[model samples]
Target: MYETFGAVVQGPRVEFHLFLPDNARDPSQYFRGGSPRIKQIHVRGDFQDAVGSQNWSLDQTFKMQRLEHPHGWLYKLAIEQDLNDGYYQYKYFVEFENGTQRWVSDPIAKYGGNDQNENSAFVIGGRHTVVHPIARRRPPRDLVIYETHLDDFTAAFRHDKTPVDAFRERLDYLQELGVNAIEFMPWTAWPGSGFSWGYDPVAFFSVENRYVDDPAKPADKLVKLMELINDLHERGMQVIMDGVFNHVRAGNDPNLGFPYRWLYQVPSDSPFIGAFAGGGFFEEFDYQNNCVAEFIRDVCLYWLDRFQLDGIRFDYTLGFFRQGDAGVGIAKLIADLHQSLNQTGRSNVALFIEHLTDNRFEAIRDTNDIGAAGCWFDPFMFKHFEYCRNGNIDSGILRILNANLDFAPGKEPVTYLENHDHSSIMQEAGGRGRWFKTQPAAIALMTAPGAVMLHHGQEFGQEEWLPGSGDGRVVPRPLRWEESPLGGDAIGTRLFGLYQRLIAIRQRHPALRSPNFFPFPFNHPEGYGAFPEQDVVIYHRWGQAEDGGFERFIIVVNYSDFDQRIDIPFATDGHWEDLLNGGVVFVDNQKLRRQKINSNWGRIYYRKA
Candidate 1:
């Protein structure tokens, strides 16, 4: 430690300075508070029985000469030297009237007990700077996304040093599953709990302490997590982090009135609810509060700048909307957040909003039109699952499809059959008895319009229902990395392979991923053609002028028990290949074509160049 000190004493102010370390950028050379939960720190020292200012500042050279002093304050404590790696013990000394000095340390130190003698310590590491370009780019419409939680991903396998490498190993499985993006559940730091599912993050600036063993140092768990992320990007996968910006845990002391003294909240005099959503679960702040905006903005920037994450799926986004042009609509916050992030001079990270409201789509459409975030098309997923899984496919499913095709002009909405909230598809609609019935509906979900989401292990029929109430959200489901095909014939594996094939096809054919697709009139018998029908629905993606323009593809779904014959009317003079079935039908002119399909086989016919 390079130790030096200077003092120009005064009553309410003083000048205290220290020498800087030779290598400032070295991670292990710096000092870190033990708990990731602590944000702002307050340190005070005394001299001649007088108390001094607790607030401190550090300059770029790690030297501070002048500092504001409170009245009756005289002597001040300063950074003697840049802290080195490993645990070091230090405390503030207060000189009393009797010439006695008292030493004190932070009360919130992690290594707790009656022993304040050994002060808090932090291990250090090098900063992470690598980022992926595709994270923030405008993606294709036909994306297959997987929702995952970091703690859950590693918890089941973390015996010795396995959690870090375990996630790395799973990357192959995710790629095999054919997902374009992986949405992580909350993994931020939380104070009281076995696992928080990252919802109760105490420190917005730091990565979750639980995931990283020695978060203070560069060679610790946080760095390992970064390695996992970088590895994922190398494989051409997009990653989205779940961002929670609504509330924080209750604080023991109130500084700015945000429950925890650490968070900056709008003063109660401001025109907003200091406490909202009853029982003070979510505190409402005045959007006029600049500090509030600054805090969240810093958090956003920190992740994008540090971790190189691709996107952020904001959780409970509707909770913070204020009543003004820039602060009123949830859209405004997202728009502003995206704009600020763009100034970082890096890849643009995608934004997605999640709110439990019918009007949520309105905000998404408005903001996305101006390039804020992509649409979260949950309603479409809900309706499809309801029709297919519940065995209630009828006019209702058609209504949903029509609305989606009409409302979404140039947006790629995220559509999913099941997510973390609805843990199990079988349990949501009915019971285990209804599991077999919903299998056909799952197929429709994968093939239907817009972006698609698949919960982890949902493909191979792993049904683990997460507890809805409490901290159990972070618990991982028993991952069947061990593939178990249904009936020893690998039926589940076959279905997963089918999904993989669709993803490959979508990636290869740009039209499948295009946002501009026109729906054709499917006049099948019994009105089941496009009414949640899997046999005879036709969809077309009008291609851009660069690729010879306007590609028309017909998607036929044969959900019936028997094979069907089609005497369809088409004005095409070329060869057509079936996407689902392994066969080709040549149509030199407008004529009828006949084909056979399995019970739940979905066939797509496209023109071959």
Candidate 2:
């Protein structure tokens, strides 16, 4: 049986368990045999008095008792006392044998302090509880994901501060846009003063206090976050958390103090020491280590169970697999995570990995019913961007589009053109409000027989580059809600309407979401023998029909800057409806010749037999 490893409180008694592997304390495991030895470990915090005053001092300490377990030694402490029914902060005080004393927060703490010190906290008898709604469930392939940072999305609207409530206020806008899921770029607590992307996570279990309206109130942060999730669920949007399990921010900055460094030091024998070149910006966890593996598993399961999150997108999965054996180690770990989630009877919960390269797809692919639901497909975005910019479709694009048309197929790839990692389509097109040119790319992304995603501002033709440092460091910027369609921007409203129309078309047609994609050889020699130029491509998607016929959709895209006429070989087309413009075209001949098409435009023709 599996058990939780943090503080478990019942009534007035709280039991704490800390797992320290035997090798963690072994002298031979260190470089110079001078690692710190356990002298005393104490839990110190403020206990709420009847008068509502907190006594912020150490009044109780525990003697170290070690018990052998399968993974390592377990340190246990149980206390019974009268306390107020609210949240309280606490830290572990550890004294080494060499007369060095340090204060560290619990590695498995579910809550933490609001100050810069970032101490851990726990709720005694709070009102926060996980409530799973039945209406918010959807399959992975059916998700239309919208990615955004919480601070970037809400900070500019109110006095440069982004509270949880402010983000909740924008749910109506997202629903109106027809997105079924929202992927938040890491909201975990990190060590930063101003706004950050939250990728450099310091506490995986705790929510960021910067988003909480009142820090003095115990469980306020957790409650607010729960409310946000509940609100999203109620509004028909599933929440997908962006998790950074590859590395953690661990450095001794003068501002953060030495306590940050003490929390991340691993045993010398651990597998995470020399995996990367030089030293990475953050401390990477040793996936091979039992304790480290358990910690990550606990973190993943904690959010799924406590917050009722629908899914998790693990950041930089490529980094984890590059460590050893070409990601076989991390594959096993992910398999275990998938298995654990399955045991909970929530099989529809999605799991995504950020492995951008095409060859890395096999490593994260679902095997033995235990693997990720899909990976972030960047080749489609890169190739589509290049074609849109140059108006030339190379053979490489054709090959990538037809790489895996049959096996596992569309359900294993999540396609997108604009996300937080890359520049927006508007910025790539010389920063003008020429969003019409990018409409072809949007058509390709949505109708490509895969799950589609969009960045926060991409729907509104946001022209400003994502505000951040060169190395993907997040910086706070002014809220551009006024630039969005919801804020009365004309171009934004127009672009938003286009996005809404395309998304609705995808939802209305089952063929668009089917796994079967057949691209005709428009320019290929000895193929369809249609357009021999590289600037035009056509594809067909079909699904089984209820009337024993087939539901067919033919998508034609023109990538050139100059308008052209192309000949399409239609198999007995009577009348086809252009989904983009709702225009009807009649075709009597087997070959529809000299069809006029605009430059950088695409159309989805629904064949009505």
lDDT of each: 0.50, 0.67
Model 1 lDDT tens row, 266-334: 223222224432221435433344434444565666666567777788776556653245543345456
Off by over 4 Å in 2: 1-3, 23-36, 48-68, 133-136, 158-162, 216-218, 253-281, 322-328, 358-370, 400-411, 466-473, 477-479, 520-534, 545-549
lDDT of 2 by residue, 316-403 (tens): 7655664334233346567777677778777668788776444644533432123567777777777777765665776565544542
Scored against the true structure, residue 188 in model 2 reaches a CA lDDT of 81
What's the CA error at residue 46 for candidate 2, in Å? 1.9
In model 1, the Cα lDDT at residue 29 comes to 20
